[model samples]
Target: MQFSSIVGQGEIKQRLINTVKENRVSHAQLFLGPEGSGSLALAIAYAQYVSCEDKSDHDSCGVCASCRKYQKLVHPDLHFSYPFFAKHKDDTALSFIEQWRDAIIKHPYLSLDIWRGYLDAENKQANINIAECHQIIKKLSFKPFESAYKILILWLPEYLDKTGNALLKIIEEPQPNTLFLLVAQNQDQILNTILSRTQLVKIPCLNDNEVKQYLINEHHQTEHAAAEIAFLSDGNLTEALAMLNNDESSYHDYFLKWLRMCFSNKGLEIVDFVDVLAKLGRENQKNFMRYGISYIRECCMLLAGAGNLVHLPAKELDTAQKMISVMSLPMAAAISELLEKAHYHVERNANPKILFLDVSLQIVKILKFKTIPQGTHYIPN
Candidate 1:
C-alpha cells in the first residue's frame, strides 16, 4: 500500500518518510491506532518506502521492482503475521496467506470481523499461535534476499497472547537491516515484554471531513449521504465503508421513532418495534445501536447548550432539538449509557428482541418517568 493511496494522516506520512530520510528508523516500532485509522496501511507504505530501490522523499516509486512486489504483498523479504483461526495446530499464517493477501489488498482498513468472513471461522477465536511465533523467529533469522532490509509486518499483535514472548529475543536483537513493524489497536492487550521493546508511533483517528471526502471521491456517494455516514461512523472508515451497503438515514428515523415510543411508554408499539429490530441481523443491529449512541450523544450536546458543537444534519438536528425538550442532560446521558450497554451486549451475541425490549423499558424509566439514578442531578425548568 502506497502512502498516497491511504486516506488522511498527512503528518504521520511525513514523519514516517523522515525516518527513512534521516536513517533513524527504529528496528522494532509499533504502529498503534484504532481500526480504520490506516495504521496497517501506513506500516506497509513505510516498509515499501524503506525497501524501494528508487524512493523519492515522500513515497516509494510505484514502478520500481521492490514497489511492484510490495504492492502485491509477494516480496521475498517482506512477511506478514496476523490473527487467524488455525484449522490445525500446525496451520500457520502461510497456510492462509492467499486469503490474507486478497482480503487486505481489497480492504486495507480491515477489521477482525471482516477478516473473519474470509475464513471458515465458525465460532473459533482468532490468535497468533505458538507455531506462528516459531515460524516468525525462523523467518527473521534469514537475511534479505532481494531488498535492502527484511521486513515483517505483524498485524494485531494483541492476539499474540503468551506465545508472543518467544519472539522477544529477535525483536530486541534482530539481524542487521531487519525491521519489525507491529500494527495493533489495543496497547494494554499486548504482551508487556513486546510492548516495551518497540518505539510507539501514535496514529490519531480521521476527522469527519476526511471521511466525507473519501466517500465522495472514492465511493461515489452524494454529498448529503457522505456527510450523514461520516457523522454516524465517527472516524471509523471501516464502518463508514460497511455502512455504504446499509441505509443510515433509515436508522435515524427508526431510532427517533423508538425513542418516541419509549417516551410514551407504549407497550404494544415497543414490542412490535423490537420485532423489527430483531430482524435487522447482527451486523445491522449493532450498527443501529451505534447510530443511536451517536445520535443521543448529539442530543446530550444540545442539552448541555452546545448546539454549535453538534454535527447532525439539519433534519436530525431539528429532531434532536424536539427530543431534547423532554430530555434533561442527565436523562440524555442516562439514555446514552443504556444504548452503550445495549451495543456491548449486541456485540456479544445477546438476543436482540430481549435486549432491545430491556433497553426500551430503561429508556421509558428515564424519559417518561424522569427516574434517573441517584447522584445524577436533574434540573427542572
Candidate 2:
C-alpha cells in the first residue's frame, strides 16, 4: 500500500519516509495506534517504501516490481505475522496467509471482530501461539530474497504470550538487514520486555473532518449524512464505514419514538417496538443501541448545563433540548447505562427481542417512575 492510499496521517507518513531517507530506519519499530486509525496501513506503506526499487522522495513508486508484489502482499521479502486461531499445535500465521491477505486487502482498518468473520473462528481464542513464535524466529533466520531488507510486520503483538520471549535474543540483536515491525493497539497488553526493545511510533486517530471528507469524496455520502456519521463515529473510521452499510439515518426518529413510548408507559406499543428492533439483525441492533446511547448522553449533557460540550446537529440538538426539559440528569444517566448494557448484550449475540424488552422496561422505570435500577446509583437533584 502506498502512503497516498491511506487516509489522513500526513505527518506520520512524512516521518516514516524521513526515517528511510535519512538512513535511520530502526530494525524493530512499533506502530502503536487505536483501531481504525490506519496504523497497520501506515506500517505496510512504510515497508513498501523501504522495499521499493524506484522510490520517490516522498513515497514508493507504484509501478516497480517490488511495489507490485508489495501491493498484492506477495513480496518474497515481505512477511506478516498476526494473531490467529490455531487448530493444530504446529499451525502458524502462514497457514492462514490467504485469508489474511484477503481480509487486509478488503479493509486495512480491520478489527478483530471483522477478522474473526474471515476464519472458521467459532468462539476460538485468537493468539500468537508458541508455534507461531518459533515460526517467526525461523523466518527471520533467512536472508532477504530480493529486497534490501527482510521485513516482518507482526500485527497485534499484544496477542503474544510469554512464549514471545523466545524472540528476545533476536529482537535485541537481530540479524543484519532484518526488520521487525509490530503493529498494536493497546500498549498495556503487550509484553514489557518486547515493548522496551522496539522504537515507538505513535499514531493518532483521524480527525472528524478527515473522516467526513473521505466519506463524501470516496464513498459518495451526502454532506449531511457524512457529517452525522463523522460526529457519531468520533474518529473511528471502521465504525463510520459500518454505519454506512446500515441504515443509521433513522436512528434519531426510532430512538425518539422509543423514548416517547417508555415515557407514556405504552406497554403494548413497546412490545411491538421491541419486535421491530429484534428484526434489525446484530449489526443494526448494535448501531441502534449506540445511537441511543449517544443521543441520551447529549441529553444528559444538556440537563447537566454542559450544552457547549454536546456535538449533536441542529435538528437533534432541538430534540435534545426539548427532551431535557422532561428528563432529569439522573434519569438520562440511568437510561444511558441501560443502553450501554444492551449494546454489550447485542455484541454477545443476545436474543434481541428479550434484550430490547428488558431495556425498554428499564427505561420506563427510570423515565416514567423515576426509579433507578439496582446496582446503578445516580445522584439525586
Candidate 3:
C-alpha cells in the first residue's frame, strides 16, 4: 500500500519516509499504536516505500512493477505473519494468507473480532503458534528473491508466547537487506526479550478533526452526523466506521424510548423491549448500552448546568433538556452506572435478555422510585 492511500498521520508518514531517504531504516522495528490508528497500514506503506524501485520524495511511484506487486501484497520479498486459529498442529499463517490479504485489503483498520468473522473460528482462541514461529524463521532464512530487501511484517506480536524466543537470533542478526516489522497494540503484553531487540515507531491515534473529515469526505456523511460519530468514536476509526454503518439516530430513539418506559414503570413494554434488545446481536447490544451511557452522561452535564459542553444534535439535546426535568444529576449518575455495568457484562457474553431486564429494573428504581443502586452512593435531589 502507498502512504498516500492511508488517512491522516502526516507526521508519522513523513518520519517513515525520512528513514528511507536518510538510509537509517532499522532492520527490526516495532510499529506500536492503538487499534484503528492505522499502525498496520503505516507499516505496510513503509515497507512498500522501502521496496519501491522508483520512490519519489513524498511517496512511492504507484505504477512501478515493484509498487504494483506491493499494492496487491504479492511481492516475493514481502511476507506477513499474524495471529491465527490453527486447526492442525502444523498450520502456519500461510494456511490463511488469502483470507489475511482479503481482510487487510478490505479494511486495514481491522480488529480481532472483525478478523474472526473471516475465518471458521468457532470459539477458538487465536495465537501465533510454535509452528508459525518455525515457519517465520524458515521464511526469513532465505535471501531476497526480486527486490533488494526481504521484508516480513508480523502483526500483533502480543499474541506471541514463550516460543517466540526461537526468532530472537534472527531478529537480532538478520541477513543483509532483510527487514522485520512488528505491528502491535499493547506494549506491556509483548515479550521483553523481543521488545529489547527492535527499534520503536510510535503511532498516535487519529484526532477528532481527522476522523470527522474522513467521514465527511469518504463516507459522504453530513457535518453534524460526522461530528457526532467522530466525537463518540474518540479517535477509533474502526468504531467510527462501524457507527456509520449502524444508525446513531436510531440509537438515540431506542435509548430515549427505553428510558421513558422505565421511568413510567411499564413492566410489560420493558419485557418486550428486552426481547428486541436480546435480538440485536452482541455487538449491537454493546453499542446500544454504550450509547445509553454516553447519552446519560450528557444528561448529567445538563443537570449540572454544563449545557455549553454538550455536543448532542438538536433533537437529542431537546430530549436531554426534557430528561433533566425528571432525572437529577444523581439519578443520571446512577443510571450511567447501571448502563456501564451492563456494557461490561455484555462484552463478557452475558445473556442479553436477563442482563437488560436487570438493568431496566435498576433504571426503574432510580428514575421512578429515586433509589440508587447499592454500589453507587448517589443521593437523589
Candidate maximizing lDDT: 1
Worst lDDT window (10 residues) for model 1?
Answer: 372-381
**Best-matching candidate per TM-score:** 1
Q: What ranges in model 3 sit over 4 Å off?
A: 120-123, 264-269, 337-351, 369-381
- State each model's CA lDDT, in order: 0.91, 0.90, 0.90
- State the displacement of the C-alpha of residue 97, model 2, in Å, after optimal TM-score superposition: 1.2
| lDDT score at residue 130, model 1, on the 0-100 scale | 97
lDDT of 3 by residue, 5-30 (tens): 88899999999999999999999999
The clash numbers for all candidates, in the given order, read 0, 0, 0
lDDT: worst 10-residue window of model 2: 372-381
Higher-lDDT candidate of 1 and 3: 1
Pick by TM-score: 2 or 3, better one: 3
Pairs that collide, model 1: none
Give candidate 3's TM-score. 0.90
Give the per-residue lDDT digits (tens) of candidate 1, residues 1-109: 7899999999999999999999999999999999889999999999999999898988899889999999999999999999998878998999999999999999899
Error in Å for residue 40 of model 1: 0.5
Candidate 2: Cα lDDT at 34: 93
